[model samples]
Structure formats: C-alpha cells, structure tokens
Target: MKALALVAALLLGTAAAGRPPEIALTFDDLPSHGPLPPGETRLSVIDGLVAALKAAHVQHVWGFVNGRGLAREAGTAGVLEKWRAASFPLGNHGWNHSDLDKVGAPSFLDEIDFNTPILTGQMAGQDWHWFRFPYLHEGSDPAQRRAVRDGLATRGYRIAGVTMSFGDFMWNDAYARCAASGNDAAIRQLEQTYLTAATEAARASRHAAQGAMGRDIPYILLMHVGAFDARMLPRLLAQYRREGFRFVTLEQAARDPFYAADVDPRLGAAPTLEARLKDAGGKPLEIPSYSEMLGAICR
Candidate 1:
C-alpha cells in the first residue's frame, strides 16, 4: 500500500509540471483597423473575426474601442453592435487613440473622458472600466506616467497590460496590397511569415516570463482587429493549442499575482517583463523583424 501511494504521488506531480500555460486574447482598434482589402468591408471583417472566435470556443474576448472611428467612418458603428451581439465585452482604447507621450496628460485624460459615453452606452451597465493604452505607451517620464495612471484610477479604469504580441498588425497593409494585385504567391509568403513570427514570439514571451518572474504567469496577448488577423485567426488559435496554451479571459488571467496592479487600479504601476529583465541584468530577446520583407514583397 505504501509503494502504490508513492507511485500515485509521483504521477500527480508529473502531470502538474506538464500543465499548459494560460493566455487571454484581447483585440485593440475595434470598429476599424489597418487598410481594408479589396473585397472586404468593415462588417465583413468583423463577421469573419467573430466566426473564427466562436469556432475556436474563445468566449469573453475584450474589444478595445477608439470612439473616433465610429464618428469618422460611416456605418462603422455597426461593427461594435455586431461585436456586442456576439456577447463579447468592450473596453475603451481612447477617443482618438492618442499617445500619452506625445499628447500630454491633460489631453490624454480628456481623450479618455470623450470615450466614456460610447463605452457606457455600449456596455449597458456591464463593467467597462478597462483601458488599453494607445500604442502601449504609458508615458515618457515618471511624472507623466503617474498623472495618467492617477487619472485612469480616478475614472474607475484598470489598465490592461500586454505580455505577448507578435506585431500582427504589421501584416494587414501588406496583405491588402497583395490582395489588390491578386498576387497569390506573395499572400502565401505573408501567411507563412505571419505564423512563424507568432510562433517565435510565443517562445520568446515564455522565456521572458521565466527569466523575469522566475515562473510563467498567465499571459495577456495583444492583437489587433485587422483584416489579415481575421483571416489567420483560426490557424493562429490552432498553433497556440499545439504549443500547449489554453485560452482564458482577461479577468481570469489578471487573477495571477503578476497582474495584481493591473487588476486593481488603485495599486502602483504594473511591473512589465521588459522592466523586470532590465532590473535582473538579463538581455532582452531579439525577435527578428519581418517589416521590411512584408513591405517589399507585397508592394
């Protein structure tokens, strides 16, 4: 009996060690993102995205909105309506997707304020107090960062921190260019490179998390609602599955201690993996850029 108990314990430990990592998917620049391809409308792009998410069983994706898009593009408001109809939550990106480092705190806060009504109406009493910084620029200096952080907290908003991204948005315009010219070969190349980048980024992010925090916390992956992303999401989700990542909600991911500050706005600034790596005197991972190749190929 003692030998059997020991064997069971060892098996359980091994299973626990082999558990997959968790990641939450969040899309920025809702309503519109990047250049639309030749045959795609904004609604069509969103419909495709919603279908892909549903097919992957990814419930509770958060779509961050920039209110200015609704006002600028006719019929774009329906994109948010369709997103809500799918039962996904919406958060504020900003009124105009302004950069805090360039726009200053006062203007940035006003941008947040301008975006509030749209979110309030769209959310309809659901919790919509999450804010994803435009371009992921918190601020240029400590004082500026503090001012914006304080402003967000005062407005009852918690910051959304990004731990993983593969520059998915960069592929959209290139895809559009290729599609316009009916360049099937170039499009195939783009698809291959896109997946390669995403795979490498996942590996690098895991390494960074282990090196910085000494363990893997649940990761929040940043993505954009661009045309190419909608086209490739089915395969991307499959790739993550193959790499042993389980999809989670943003709130669920935030429950990890690494996201404590992000979960509670009143806490101090969240510690990023990059900052942690710098403090530990470790070098950052150098993920290769496909921007030049992406640009030159399709054009």
Candidate 2:
C-alpha cells in the first residue's frame, strides 16, 4: 500500500506539471451566416458549430453579432442572454455590418452609438471596449486609424488587429469543391492550406521581429464563426498542437507585444492588435480582402 501510494503521488505530480494551452480561438460574426437564401438548412449547421466549440471547452468567443442580425435571427433579448449565459466575451461588429472607413467618423461613431443602447440595456450596463474594423480595415489613412482610436478612446473601445493568418475561407471551399469533385478534396486542401498558412505566419512574424518569432509570441488566430470553420476546428487544433501550439483565448493571446503593437508594460498602454498581414507568397496581404486573392475565401 505504501509503494502504490508513492507511485500515485509521482504520477499526479507529473500530470499537474503539464503545460497549459497556448492557442486562442477567436470567432468573428457570431451566428452570422452568409445571405439567407431561402430554404433554411443552415440553422443546424450553426448549432453544430457552436456545439463543437462548447464541446472543445472553448469558453471565450468574440462574437461580432450585428444588432440588426440579432433582431432578425437570434432575437436581441435571447441572443444577448444566451451569450452572456455562456460567459462568452462579446464585441460590437458595427451598427449594420457596414464599412467603418468608408462612412467617416460621424457615421462610424453612429455605428458605436447604435449598439451601445442595446448592450447597456440588455446586458445591464456592460461596457464593450473591443472593436473589429469591418473587413478588418482600420482606416484608409494613418490619421483614420488614429481617429478611430480616438473614437474608441472617447467611448473606451480597444482596437483589435490579427496576428496569425489562415485560409479559413478556403477550408469551406475545399469541402464544397471536394464534394463536387469527389474524395476528401476539402480535407486535403485544408491540410495543405492550413500548414502553409501556419508556417508562413510563423515565418512572417519571425521576419517582422527580425528574428524573434518563436513559441513565446502570443498569437491571435483569425477564424470566422461559419459552419465549415467550426467543422474543421478539431483537425486545425491537432495541426497546431503538432506544431507545438496550445489553445488559448483572445484575452490571453493578445497580451503579447508582437501581436499588440503598443502595449507598454511600463506606462501600461495595453498593446493594441497590430500586425502586418502577408499573403501566401510572403507578400503583404492587402486589406478589403486578404488571403482571398486566389479565390480561396469564396466558393
């Protein structure tokens, strides 16, 4: 009995010392599917996607549910309550999913205004400080980024950008085309593209720091909350795990200075999300539609 107890204690100690998860799963457009084209078959897909996340124990999700969409699909009261119930972190996508830069500051601020009431009213005075620029375009001008930053400052919003990149769009296309073309075409494409994106992102970040990209940098991976993305979650996680990455949430991953451009640990300016996006060719992926230049995002 004494020998057995000693062995059990050693095993427990080894298990307790295992590394914590390091990858952050950030989902955009909470429950926002593409255009509702008639026969409602996607509702289940959405549910399945959410179920997968829940099953994987993914607690924090950055849901970008537009107010209008909430009223239309998941009813504002119910969606708000459900998200809050899940303890999922919420952020404003925009008023109506419109482009912030094109509309200018007045209209942009209006977008913030449009949702503030709902958040304050339904969530009971919940303050949302994180803002995702529509289409991930901070602004057309450096001043515009500053202006949007100032707007967030006026209302206490945090400007978020992305760190690691992926062809999440292509993941879906591959599945669809593979089904059409037969075989595990989507899976194969996903395997190829997924590895490419991950490797390339690592390379880009390393190059960006001029040779500091390692396991230490907190990586913010961008993923849409679409069915296909959710479907590919397991395999994606496995791939990253093999590459020696652990799963974390946006709040934790965004803490790294590489992803957060200006978080001064001294004076305490929480690092904002700012990273240079690169295409598969290792060139800069332009805004308005990145990683989609090869029609990877669209079917």
Candidate number with greatest TM-score: 1
lDDT of 1 at 34: 95
Which lDDT tens digits does candidate 1 get at residues 107-149?
9999999988988898899999999999988877888888888
Compared with the true structure, the alpha-carbon lDDT of candidate 2 equals 0.55
Q: Alpha-carbon error at 291 in model 1, in Å? A: 1.2
Each prediction's TM-score against the native? 0.92, 0.68
Tell me the tens digit of each residue's lDDT in model 2 across 1-299.
34323433443343345543255766666546443222323454455556666776767766665676666765334545555666776777777777756788678778877877766665565655566666766666656566666767667666555665654654554455444545564456555555555445544443343223323355566676555565666656655554455567676766765544333211223322223223222343222323453355225
Clashing pairs counted in every model: 0, 8
Mark the regions of model 2 whose C-alpha exceeds 4 Å error after superposition: 1-21, 35-43, 71-82, 121-127, 173-215, 258-299
